[model samples]
Every structure is written in C-alpha cells, then in structure tokens.
Target: MVARYVVSPRGGRRAYPSIASALRAAAARGRPALIEIAAGRYEESLVAQGDVRLVAADGPGSVVVNQLRGTVLQTYGSVQVDGLVLTNRDTEYDVVSCWQGSLTLDNVEVRTPGGVGTHARPNTRATLRNSVFLHGRTLFTASAGTIERCRFTDAADNAVAIIEGAQVSVRGSRIEGSRIHGVRVCDARAEVVGCELTGTGNAALMADTRAELAVADCVITAVHAEGIMFIEQSRGSVDRARVTDARHGVGAASGADPVVRDSVFTACRDTGINVQTDARGRFEDCRVVGARNIGVFSTKGGAPEVHGCHISGGNVGVAITEGARGRFTRIRIEDLTTTALRIFDPDSTGVFEDVRVDRCPAGLEVRGNGGTTAEVTRAEFHDFDQAAVALAGQCRVTLTGVTADRGMLGLGIGEEAQLRAFDCRVTRVSSGGAVVFGSARLIAKNLTVSGSEALGICGRNSALLDITHGEFTDCALVGAAFDDECTGRLVDCSVGGTGDMAVRHNGLVDLASLTTSLPVVRNREPVPLPPTIINVINIINQKIITGPTIHGDAINNNFAWGNDHVIQNQPTEEGPRT
Candidate 1:
C-alpha cells in the first residue's frame, strides 16, 4: 500500500537527516516498510513499531549514525539494518536493542567514542552477520538466533554471550581483547565454529549452566586463563581446534563431560586436559605437549577415554587417580621429571593398550586403597632410573607383550599385588633384573631376561610365583631366586649363565621338561604332575592304539599362569603336589 510519511523531530521545516524522516514515514504507515538512509550524519534516537528494514545508501563507514546521548535504535519486531557505521554511541546502555524482535545486520558497526568499554548490550536478539561490534561490553546476545562472520574487539565483558534458551551459531568470527571471556554460552545450545579468540581474562570459550556447546576448527591463543572451561553439567565437544599459550588448555569440571578430539594443546601452564567432579568424556587423537602441571588429569570420579594421543613434557604425563578411570590406547608419552603415569589413591581404572613411555622418572606407578586393573599390551619402556613398571597396594595388573630395557629394575611387584606378565621382555639392566618383589602372587610366561646384575627373578615377601617358557641369558647371578616364602613352578624354561649359576630357584616344580643341563629346582622339592603324567601315559597308550597325541597338554606341557587363573599343581595321588 502506498505508505504514508511522518518525519521525526516532526516539523514542517524538513529539518532532520533523511534517515529520521524515513523512519517517521515508515511508522506513520504502520506496516512493514523500508527506510532508505542516505549517506549522511543522522543524530537521533530510533524506535521501531513493527517489522522494519533500515537500508543504507553506502557501506559500513559511509552511512553514519552519530549519537551522542545514548541509544540509536530500539525495536520491537523483526528488523534488518545493513551497511551502516554507527559511531559515538552510548557507553552506558546499548546502542541498538531488539528486545522482542530479531535483527539482521550486515557490514554494520557500533563503536563508542570512548575506549573499548562502550555499550551494555551492543546488539541483542540479533543476527550480526559480517558486522564489527567494536568497543562494547558485548557484541551481541543471540537469545535464539545466529551470528556469523562477526568481529568483537576490546570488550569489557564477554564479547558474545548467548543465553536464555537460545541456540546460537557463531561461525568465522574473531573475539579478542576481552576483559573477561571471549565468548560465553550458558543455559543454551551454542556451536562456535572457525573462530579465533585471544587475550581473554577468563576462558576463551566457557560453557556453563547445563548447555551443550560444540567448538570446531577454532584457534585460541594467549589466553590469560583457561582456553576452554566447561562447568555445571554442560556437555561440550571441542574438535579440530588448537589451544596454545594458555593457563589451562581445557578444563571440564562440576559434573560436566567435555570431549576434546583431534585438537592440539601446547605450552599450557596447567594441565592440558583436566576433568574433575565425575566428568565422563572422551579425548581421541589429541596432542598435548609442554604442559607445566599434567598432560591429562582425571580427578574426582571422571572416566575419560584417551586414545591415539601423544602427551609429553609435563610433571606427570597422565595422572588418573582419586576415582578417575581412563581408557587409553596408542598413547606415546615420555621425558618427565615425576611419574609418567600415576594411578594412586582410591583405585583408578586405566586400560592401556599399546602405550609406550621412553625415559620417564617413574613408569606406570599405581597404589592406594582400591586396586587398579590394566590390560597392558605391546607396551615398551627404555632408559629409566627406577623400575619400569611398579604396582603396589593390593592392585591386580596384567602385562602382555611388554618390553622393559636398561632400567634399575624391570618390574617391582609391591606387597599385596597380584600381577601377571605374559610374553614380556626385561633386558640390559644393572641392578635388579626381571623383578624385585613384595607381591602376593605373580604369574609370568615367555619372560626373556638378558644381562642383569642381581637375581633375574626375585619375589621377596610374596607368596606364589609361576614362571614358564622363560629364557634368562648371560647373567652372572642366580637366574631364579624366590625369597621370603616365595614359591614357584618352572617348566619348559632355560636359565643360562656365563659363569656358574643357572636356575638357582627356591621353589617347587611339577612335570617340567626342563631342557637346561642343570636341574630346574635347587632348594625346593620337585614332583611329577598327575595330570601331566596321566596325559603322557594316555598319549603313549594312544600311540600304541592308533597314532601320536597331537596338540595335547602333556606334549607341550601347558604351564601358563595369569592373574585371573589360579596356579595349582597337577592332581596326583600325593594329594595335590606343589
């Protein structure tokens, strides 16, 4: 309908700028209308009644709205402001407020004449796409909208704070020089993508108030505080992002579970990934290097997955204790002053599959009240002052395909530990050779120990030791010595020595086909296993009846022991021979 015109500052003299006149005309029409603002200085306050579109005749720096008092535009309905420069706005309140409306601003700017701290709500409710919100407390608050390709600099508070049931998408934006957080999203769903944020007092991106925020392909550098902080049951995921030179790269606390994947966090003052307060999350394929405290810390009942990641250069590479259970695979960590992996106090569960630590202070340290169970496979260690793997305090651990070379002690099974090492290699050590013991029970198979100074296998103050399929080569000391009530059964194993001693054991054996020239047992008694002898007799009877007993336990003398299974002598008429 051919709209009516009502010029503001309402005079017949036609005195205000054309923008004020056009707004008056659009309001007079009482419907959806377009206000064509010419390239000039419009000094006035605008209040929209209904749906309106404010179109500028020039670009962002051309068409200017010079407001000295305070607000420039306050709207009630859906509005669109395009291609305008709004300068010298109010520092007290907002320059533009879309209280009940949605705003779309393209190439628009709202800057204060004062310093960076300018407006309270620079642009609210608003989709500020391709806009520059400079010198404000907040660029915008999209309560239920999107903001794309926007830049917010020198903000007194958060550059962008999305709240109030709003699901905002801030993409391809830059938030820098913030007094507080760069982008804060709380009580809402937020997805921040392809953004660069730096120089924040708080976190670069903070997700609180039970919101789910996903940050992808973003770069956060030189953050004065944490790079990303997730709290209050917020489920956040940070992927393909880089967080460097921050106090903390990522922190997920207060019952929040945040996942970080394919991200790199380097040169952080605190931990690279710290999860506290029952935070259950996953970190896949991430690299955390040069952290001041810990590479990955899971405290207070947080169960996290750390897979295919590299953590290096920290006080502790991975500290999972105090009820923190972490599942790890393919984690390569090394070169730390204290504890490569520490699982202590209240029994943490860590499943390390194919994890390697090269030259750390203490390797795989576990202690405390509740026991930690780990399925370690294909793990290798080299060049350590202490034991390669140490387990203490009633813990149950299993090691398969583990190799330890050039260490003071290969494996230290502390008192009350039930450890099983299968197909493990311990070689080239000066002090303690394969094991220095204080364990309850230790079952080992296919153990290769070469060039050790002390006893090859020493289980002191421990109860049971089952060693099978072992090769102890070129050792001057006793190959197998069980002291302090330690008893073992050795079978199908060779203990070779350069000088004299071979299989100087203090244990018992049953039905062992020991190929060594020396006897398998030294001080302990040796007996025939009934199951082995019966199977042998049955095999001989079968050879007389038909053919050989192929794949029989007696043929190979199956004598493997693990942590899960009990090591027992074969049933005999001598009442369970040991």
Candidate 2:
C-alpha cells in the first residue's frame, strides 16, 4: 500500500518538477514507491528498480544529490535512502551503488572527491545508519554490512573495505583521516564495536586473505603502520584494545593466529606484540608502554603466549628471536632500556613464570646462536645494571624461585652457558654472586649469597661450578672463588663475614664439607685437598694458612690464644688434628 510521489524544484502543488519526473511517476505505479524529495539541487543520476523509498523533504541540508559524473545512488531491488546528501564530483565512479540490492541508509551523507563511498556489489546487502563518509577513495565496499552511527572521514584508500564473503558489523564507528587502511578485511568477516581509529596511514586493523576479525571496544590512534595487522591465514580477536602511536602493536605474520585480550599498547615505535612466520599469538591482560623496540616480539617460528603482562618503557622487554618460542606468565618488566628477557635464536625456546625485572640493563639475556633454551620460574631481578641472569653462547637455562636484588652481575654465566639454579637468592650484588666464565656450567641448589661486593661464587675460564647447599654472608671479597682452568664442587658450604677470603682456589676445587666463620683456606695456586674445614670457629686475628695442603680433620679447630692458626701436618699430637 506504498505509493506516494512528490518532487519539487520550485513550483509545488502535487509536485513533480524534476527528480526525473518523480521517478517516472513512481515507475508508472508498479508497486512500492515513496519518492518525496524537495528543497534543493538535484542534478541527479539515480536509478532504482522494484521497491524504492528516497525520502528527504526538508532534512539532510534540504536534499541534494549532485552526481556531476557517474554514480550517485543506483540500487536494484529494495532501497530506502532517507534524508540524503550524496555528492560524488567524480574522479571516476561510485557514491552509493548497490547491485542485487537491499540497501538502507538513514541520515546518509556521502561526499566523495575521488571515488568509492559505499559500493556494495557482489551479493549485496548494506545498512548504514547516521552515516557520513567524506573525501573518499574507498569508504565502505561492504559486501554485506551494518554500520551504525558511522563517520569515516578523509579516507584515501580503505576505511572499511570488507571483501569476498563479507560479513561486516561496525557499531558506533569513527574512522578518521585514514590514508591507507582503517579496517580492510579480505576474505571477510569483521565485527568492530565501539571503534575509534584515528589518523591511520597504513594498518589500523587490516586482516588479509582468510580474514576473521573481531575488535571490541577499540581505540587505535595515530597508526602509521601496524596497529592490528593479521596477514595470510588471518584470524583475529582483540578485546578492550587501546593501541597508540603504532608501528607494530599486534602484527601477526604469514600463518596468523591472534587472540589479544584486555590490550593496551602505547607509544609503540616497533613491536608491542609481533608474532612472525609460523605465528601463534595469545595474550591476555596485556599492557606494553613506551616501546621503542620489542615489547613482546617473537620471530621466525613464532609461538607467543603471554598472560598477565606488563612491560614498561621498553627497548627489549620479551624478545625471542629467529626460531622463536615464548610462553610467559605474570610478567612484569619495568623501565627496560636494554634487555629484560631476550632469548636469541639457535632454535630458541623460552618459558617463564611470574617474572619480574625492574630498571633493567640486562635481566635475563640468553644468546648463543642456536641451542637457546630458557626456562624460568618465579623470577625477580631488581635494579640490574648488567647481569641479572645473562647466559651467552650455547645457552640452556633453568631457574626456579630465582631472586637477584640490586644487581650488577648476579648470575652471569658466559659462553657454552648451562645454568640450573633452584631456590636461588642473591642479594645486594655489585659484581659477583654466581659468575661462571668461558666453558660455563653452574648447577646450584639452595644457593643464597648476601650483601656481595665481589666474589661470592665466582669461577673463571674453564668453568663448571656445582654448589649443593651454599650460603655466604656479607662477602666483600672471596667466599668461594675458583680461578683460570676452573672446576668446582662445594657440597655443604657456609661462609661468614668474608671481607678477605674463605675458600679461594686456583684450579680444581672439591670441598665436601666446608664451614668457615672467617677463614678456612685461601690458596692462590696450590691446591690438593684444602677446604674440608668443617665448622672452624676461632676468629681473633684470623689467618688460616695462605697455601692449601690442609687435609680434612682439623679436629674442631678453636684457636684464639694470640692466634697464629696455621695447622700444617699437625699430627704431633691429637690436640689440633682431632
């Protein structure tokens, strides 16, 4: 029962002056038609087929559809464009061109200086409410769509270009000043809710081939490059997103797999979430701030799973290289300028849990070409200037319940690195608390080194240090130090306030049971069987032999009489060699 036609340029009275004679008198009254256009410039180029209703009596700046070149409204079956103002001064074509149509645009305003602004063609179905698409190159190609309260301004390339098997739903949208891509899905399926993409040149949401994107509560700002770009086998899901100043904030490569939840990436110049080649990404409760480079970056064989993340002021906070693999949980890396967790190639693998590194220069940097494996659990390295866990070449690390405070070399095992520390705690370190050099291998068990100024466990060149149950107190110089062609084994060790020396060897050191309250053995070169001094406690002017040949039983040594404690082959009686 829809048939009402009234069009007027000036002379009214059952009007019908222009509007192509009221669409040929509503297609000779064939069926449903309501063409009520009044008030102004209608230099028209309109074409509709069966059911049409183009109503704009006084609203939409008083009706103007001035297509000076090609298409300005061309529908097929069912169309309803109410309160219109479509321009299209034509650099070539489209400004609203639906084909096998069911188009509905209420309060529409599509002003194009160059081309496409709403061209829903292949298996068409479009619906835009309270719309505005200005200065368009491509603003909405929408194969099947629903864009509510939209405003896509100054779009030169793509502001919503959902392709092939399209399913688009964008609510409360505002894509602003987009030169390249602000939402461009290929084998499409896009659902962006409460979106606000600002000043995007390249990628503010660009999902390629096998696209399926769902971005909720989005606010992507100043994106010069990737702020959400999922390539080849594209798959995306970003919730509560806030990406700012992006180069790469969520960029998944070839085999893309993206699931980023509760995201917040700010001031990103390079990578705040970049999973490469064999991509697998899943981040929950994420936040990466002020990233100049690498706040979560996995390379070639990428495997990323970061949960409860917070990385701040980054240079490299979480960077797993070439043959990448990463799995982090409860990570908190703060003020990182150099390395807070950087596991370089060599078939890389990193598994961290409850990691916390603060003010980093280098906190957990495992690099050595190709056999990198870092497995950390409950780690906390604070105020690191250099090495709070730095294993160089042939890296294989395993740390459980690790803690290094005020660090400057707390666990720095160099080339051929292999470290296994369990229940480790190194406090107030300046230079050394666990430093094994060249052919590095350190296997510690309940190691605790207090206020260390220099050597509390330090092994050199051919290093392989193994401490079972070690504890060193206020060590300013030496509590366990092995030299050049080093090799060590301190089973049940304990050293007190060592300002000078307590167990210092040259090459091969094996102390089964060593407990020194002050001085036990400090040999620079000579060593056969020194440190077996079990609980030697007589600290007056402590100097317990500068050369090592002191074998096991120093018989509960307690010498403090004008102390000249030098027990060298004391079997003259059973008094000192007990």
Task: Report the number of the highest-TM-score candidate.
Answer: 1
Mind giving the per-residue lDDT tens digits that candidate 1 earns over 1-578?
A: 53433233333444344566676667777888766555666677777667787767555666777778767777777778888777664566677766665677788887764333212132346677888887675433335667788888878778877765567788999999887898887887889999999999899999998988999999999999999989889998999999999998988888888888899999999889888888777899998999998998888888788889898887788888787788889999988776677776666777888888888856777665545666688888888766677766677788899988887667766557677889999888654455534445678889888887655765544457777898877665556555545566767777666623555444333326444433333433322222322322232233211235333334535322112122323322222223
| Root-mean-square deviation of Cα positions for candidate 2 versus the true structure, in angstroms | 15.0
Taking all chains together, the TM-score of candidate 1 against the true structure is 0.79
Against the true structure, candidate 1 has what lDDT?
0.71
Query: With candidate 1 superimposed using the best TM-score fit, by how many Å does residue 467's alpha carbon deviate from the native?
Result: 2.5
lDDT of 2 by residue, 213-267 (tens): 9898889888899888888988979998899989988888888887999889998
Compute the lDDT for candidate 2.
0.78
lDDT of each: 0.71, 0.78
- The candidate maximizing lDDT is 2
**Off by more than 4 A, model 1:** 1-15, 18-21, 30-43, 55-58, 62-70, 87-92, 112-125, 135-142, 461-464, 484-492, 497-500, 503-515, 518-578
TM-score of each: 0.79, 0.45
**Candidate 2 lDDT score at position 49:** 74
